[model samples]
Target: MRIGITYTILRREELEIKERAGDFGEVFMLHEDDMVFPSNLDLDVVIIRNVGHFKALYLARLFESEGIPVVNPFTVMLEAGDKLLATLRLKDRVPVPDWRAGVSEKASEKAVEELGYPVVLKPVFGSWGRLLAKVNDRDALEAVLEHRKWLRNPLYGIHYVQKFVEKPGRDIRSYVIGGEFVTAIYRYSEHWITNTARGGKAEPCYDEEVRELSLRAWEAFGEGALAIDIFEGSEGLLVNEVNPNMEFKNAARVTGVDIAKKLVEYALEVAKA
Candidate 1:
């Protein structure tokens, strides 16, 4: 079976992912501009790197309409991609960090009251530490909004706000596949954002609670390959977000889980049906 894998041209690791894809089947790397596929040649599945990119998202839609399987279906990624929606989905399953929608100036104020002061405002759709700021008071919050408007950032209008958990820059990342635990890690940084993209370092963590939360999130997503981000605070462990298209290189390194083989095996099984 032939399969397609994608990563943004901006991300330097796209080639590395292609090398791994070779082991499963015929692998082709695509740039957004060069991404057209022939309908005549049937492909079994497409493994997307970042569904946030238009090229990859469009390809997912194409594969879905043609009845070709998408790893972590376009539907699941589309739903979970929205950070606000992802948080809400975990409400009953796990205790989530306090969050709110800053749809307008007044809405931001209301969310602040509901969630309390020293809250964090982030773009509803964002990754890494892009366009994020902590708003401790009304003035600071309004200033951030104005600054974004002055810079012509379109998302300045309305966004999401969450209560800032006090921690010394540490968090947990756990991987799950078909509702089974793969592995986990402790990501640490001196800054507010703990993304490996933001220079966070990975350390080993094999806590049982980490395993439990990871499985709960996987079950919440109806069992797909996923990464669940969690935070340890004074209130104990709380879920952060789930990204089906999450990066795996570091998680694999720290946890010693061979995620590539596992993902390919599951994708082929689902595609065969």
Candidate 2:
């Protein structure tokens, strides 16, 4: 069997995945700088890593056109890579926080007003909790919007506003592999945004609601390997986001799950199928 991983630079998780996958078969590290589009490559299955969305989509679609399976699939990547798309897809199917999408400053203001104060203004396409603003009032919303208007990337102009949920100083990050819930962790921080990338600490959590909701969210996205971010809301557990190419080094350390090994084993299963 042959497995291909798309990456520009190898992070800790990527290196771990590479090492574990090597135990199965020949592993090809398809670096972005060395790849050429519209060319046929021999590989049984391709695992899309932390590459950018457009490039990852291009590679996945190219390999898929030639009958090679892609982890998380191109469809999942298409939706999960964009916060707006993922929210729309997960709405109604799962318990997701209320959100609105728009393109103009006026529309963003209107959305903020509708969603009420303390709303989260997020870039449509972002991760690691970067470029997220917790707008407490009109003044803050105006300031954030004005800054976005000057940015070169038009994607910055697009607004993804969500109602902020008041949690108990932490949130749950659940790992789903091959349609199964492997483990979960509580990311705690004094700040409102509790992303581990933002210096939030991780602790092991074994919650039934997290598993059920995470599984439902994974199935909503046509399940593969995903990290589901869930918020404990006043009503119930709400899914905040679903990441296709998730970062799991912190989660692995806290949860004691050999995530890379399980991920590689699943990728090999895809290759075998």
Candidate 3:
């Protein structure tokens, strides 16, 4: 089997995944620093990782055009990379937080009003809780919208307003690999945002409800390797986000699962199929 991984700068998890891939087949690390499509791709399967959504989509399409299988295929990336798109897909299939999306500042303000204060203002495309604002009032929402407008990035301009579900100062990050729920962690933090990248602590959790919802969420995205960000709402587990390019170094250490090895094995399985 020939396995290829798309990456920008190799992170810890990427290096580990590459090493594990050696056990299965010849491994190729296609560096995205050049952002150039390979003139020739000799790989049977690709595990897309460590690249942005647009870049990942580009590579997935390129590889897929040549009949090379891509894990978390282009369809998955298209929906998971955009929060609004994911929300729309998961809203009917699984439990999800109340959310609204708008293109202009006035439209966002209306959405904030409808969802009420203390809503989370998120960029349509982002991760690690960056550029996320928990707006408790209209003034704060206005300020955030103004700042986003100043940045002038079109994605930032499109506001994603989600009704903030109250939790115990934490949320759940569940891992689902190849259609099976693998493990989950409770990200504990003092602040509202509880992402590990923002200093949230990871602790093991084994909630069956989280597992079921996670699997359903994965199926909603066509079932690849995904990390489902869920919140324990008053009603039930509400999926906050679905990550196609999920980073799992912390998750592996906390769960004691060799995530890299599992990912490599799944890639090889895809190659065989």
> What digit string (tens of lDDT, one per residue) describes model 1 on residues 52-163?
6345556778777887787777767765666777777787898888888866767777888899889888776667868778888878977887776686655566678889
TM-score of each: 0.89, 0.95, 0.96
Model 3 over residues 1-273: C-alpha lDDT tens digits? Answer: 889988988999999999999888899888877546554778989999856778887788888888999887888888888999989889989989999888889999999889987899999887888888899997898899889989978889778899988998889999888987888999999998999989999999888888889999988876578889999899878999989888888888898988888888878777888
Superposed Cα RMSD, model 1: 2.4
Q: In angstroms, how far off is 210's CA in candidate 3? A: 1.0
What value of lDDT does candidate 3 attain over all alpha carbons?
A: 0.87
In the range 178-237, model 2's lDDT, one tens digit per residue, is 887899999999999899999999999998989999998888787579899999999999
Instruction: List the candidates ranked by lDDT, beginning with the highest.
Output: 2, 3, 1
State which candidate has the highest lDDT.
2
Cα error of candidate 1 at position 229, Å: 1.0
Model 2 stretches astray by more than 4 angstroms: none
